[model samples]
Target: MSALVPALEVFLVFLRLGLTSFGGPVAHLGYYRAELVVRRGWFTEAGYAELVAVAQFLPGPASSQVGMASGLLRAGWPGLLAAWVGFTLPSAAVMFALALGMARWGEVEGAGWLAGLKVAAVAVVAQAVAGLWGQLVTDRRRAVLALGVAAALLVLPGAGAQVGALLVCALAGWHLLPAPQSTERGLPAVPVSRRVGATLLLVCGAGLVLLPLLAPLSEVWALLNATFRAGALVFGGGHVVLPLLEAGFVPALVSHEHFVAGYGAANAVPGPLFTFATFLGAAQTQMPPLWGAVIATLGVFLPGALLMAGTLPFWAVLAARPGARSALAGLNAGVVGLLLAALYTPVFTGGVRGPRDLAVAVLAYAALTAGRLPAWAVVLACAAVGWAVL
Candidate 1:
């Protein structure tokens, strides 16, 4: 009964965050810091920083991983589940509902509002690229690495190339880049055991390998496989998942316009940007809408959840290793490159049709970075402008 109370508390707190946290992944981190670190004191500053580091080092939504870690520290395994469900439920529901609307109103493809949403995606992704570049491309080596990865993807352009670029960057970082100094803060004591962590990691690996083979069986399998791969390989942050998901679903599963629009809608909603999967899943025509939403949401989130849980027990050891740190640095730079390529292709090309559209995007970018408007407000403003002018 006492344990149950803690898990319930975890759920309620995260549910509130899901309902209210906005502005995308970076902003979501600030909200988490304020709520958990400042108000409730669930973790010390250094402890929370350590948790964030672990999430960034692993492939998943970094903010969501931090939430999971917080829940695990507070209430054990039950807390982890509780945290994810609470934080994810609100946005997932909203995105799925939007998918339903799109399904029914097939003519919305030509709607001005939809076009606005697509255009808003341009500014949103540009903001992400700029932010990531500032953080990841700190040195000349990292800049070269990021530019090289971007150039490679621009030339070749596919999921295979993205993955290959990440691999090459990791190797380069390991061999050439200097190791980053370890942070002084120690990790909090997590309840997971090393054995359990190892088992979970094995499951993540097995899914990556087996899901693809099983994808030929049905639409459900294919949806699960694609979403799972996106979750597993996404390294930097939620925005970085864009190109991977775009590669998996665009044109074939979901239309290009719908893809861009859904991404824009994702910015307007609270909680994890990864909930964008819920919208994509439900929007697909091959499977039952609700069922697709459920499966896609689960598949995209599962790998990250498993990896975060598995790595918690091993994080202390890994954080101390210089080689691991260097590789992660390289991988992060590669991620910036991947996002840069995506911004130009699907985000820019899909959204901007003329000078008018470019003007709207520039204004939207200014509103976000300079005016400091909330992302939802900016998205809504862009939609209005796109409807009236563009």
Candidate 2:
């Protein structure tokens, strides 16, 4: 009963989060930290930091992982399920509705708000890189490793090139980067019923592995499978998942324009950026609007549940391992590099197109960092600037 209380409360709170967590992964993190950590006594600051680290290592949406971790901390399996569903449902529903409207009305034109929205997105990611880097890349050697990784990602173009670069950087950081002077605390231990967790993991793993083989090959299945894969392999955060989804879906007939449009829209909406999957699923093929809605809803969120279920058994074990900790440290550095690259290329270069844009961005940054403005306020103010200027 005591455990259930927190889990139920988390479900309700995250339901609200899913509905109104606009501005993508970085923004979502800000909201979560603000709402859950600072405002609510749900988790300690250190505990939230640990969850962020662990979530970055896993291959799925980072926010979903954070929510799942929050759920696990509160309850057990039921709590995890509740968190995933609560966090995912609101955005999924909205994306599905948007998809239906898109089918009826055609590509949403004159959503001129996206221009400013994307700039805000950039500012948010830049802030994340700055904040996380200071926390994660404490030493000079680690900073050098981060810079080298950023360089490789910028220069290289190919299959797995970015991933390979990240792996190499992680290895370099692990071997060459100085260890923390004070030992880092390991993740909390959650004692689960071994049989139940193992059963859940096996079932989910098997279902995900076999779904494509058994199901009919079509655009729907492809989108579902691709999204599932994206949800599985995307470590770090939501922005990091973009490239993988672009590589997987765009080449296979998913329109780059639609994808970018969906991403832009997702940033405007409040919720997890994983809702981008919902958007993609709905727009995958020119199916009936209802079909699109249903398919997209299922496709986007199925992986969240499966990934959590499958990974549950190993959470305690993996968190306890020294090698895992070292690898996670490296991955954390890689994540910092990835965020840094995002800051430079798409976020910075694309957003700050001219002197006015630069001025707006600098002002926004100053407000966020120095003036201590709320994130949503900064975003809204920037949107106003984009409308007036751009």
Candidate 3:
């Protein structure tokens, strides 16, 4: 009963965030910081920063991971599950509904509202890149590293390049960047045991390795494998997962038009951008829409949950080390570069059709950064603009 109360509280709080948090992963972090750190006093500022660092260091949705970690700290394992479900359900439901509509109506090629959503996505990704660049690329060396990563990916675009750039940046940061000074503040005691943490990690690894082998057995396994790999391997979540997902589904399972449109719709909805997987799963023709949604959503989210639970017990010691901090710094910059590349190729290319679309995107960007309009509003305004003008 005592445990259930905190878990339920966590659920309601996250459910609200799920409904209201917008502007992509970075904005979601701000919401989390305000709600969990400032309002609830669930964690000290330093402790919260450490939690963010751990989430960013892992290979999944950073905002979702942070939320999961917050829940774990607040109310144990049950809290972790509660936080994820509450935070994910709203957007997942929205995306699933969008998918159902797309399935029934067929491809919505050149639809003005869809075009507006795509254009809005451009502004959203641009905002994310600008925000992240300011936060991550602090020094000259880091800036150079970010540029190099962007250039590399733009020149040779693929999941391989994305993953490789991150790895190289981590190595560069470890070897070249100055070590960070140790902080006195540490994380609150996590509820997980080291043994439990190790077991979780092992399970996560086993799923990553084994799921691929099982993918040939059925469409369900194949979908799970693709979504799981996307969730398990990507460094920075949100827009960063775009390429991996495009590679996994586009032209094969889900059409290119639907893929781009769904991404745009995802920006319009509140919650983790990862719930875009829900859209993809439901939009695909390989299986029943609801079943695909269920599998894809669970598969994509499972790795992050597992990784966060597995690493919490060891994070304090790992975070205390300077080398880890330096590497993370480099990796973060690389992520910015990756987003920069994505902004150009898929986001910009797919969103902007001509001068009119570009104009709409520029206006939307101004609305977001200067006018301080919320992302959902920007999305709607862009859709309106697309409907009326574009």
- State the C-alpha lDDT per candidate: 0.80, 0.65, 0.82
Better of 1 and 3 by TM-score: 3
Q: After superposition, how far is residue 322 of candidate 2 from its true place, in Å?
A: 4.2
Candidate 1 displacement at residue 196 in angstroms? 1.2
By TM-score rank, best first, the candidates go 2, 3, 1
Best by lDDT: 3
Residues 1-390 of candidate 3 have per-residue lDDT tens digits of 876999999999999888766556755675675577545778754466567657766899988999999999999989999999999999999999999875544444556777787787788778767766775678999999989999998899865677788889989989888765554243568898989999999999999889989999999998999899999988756778889888888887899999988987787677899999999999999899999999999999999999999998987666567897777667767877876887887778888989989989899889878887666577778778888877
Candidate 1, TM-score vs. the true structure?
Answer: 0.65
Clashes of each: 0, 4, 0
Model 2, 1-390: lDDT tens digits are 776786788788788767645556645665566556545657644345556655554566777777876777667767776787787888777776675565433333334454565566566666666766776777776687677767776776322555676677657756765444324533445646557667766765675797667446766666566666676666556766687678656846458877787776665566777777777767666566556556655655556555554565575566456655555566667767765765776567666667767777777778767887656677777777777776
Residue pairs clashing in model 2 are 20-270, 21-270, 21-271, 22-270
> Which TM-score value belongs to model 3?
0.67
lDDT of 1 by residue, 1-390 (tens): 887999999999999888766545645665575567645778754456556556756788888988988899899999999999999999999999988875544455566765676677677767767766775578999999989998998899754576678889878988888776654233467798899999999999999999999999999899999899999999767888999899889987999999988987786677899999999999999988999999999999999999999988887566558886787677767867766777787677877899988988898889768886655566678778868876
Mark the regions of model 1 whose C-alpha exceeds 4 Å error after superposition: 103-187, 317-390
**Ordering by lDDT:** 3, 1, 2
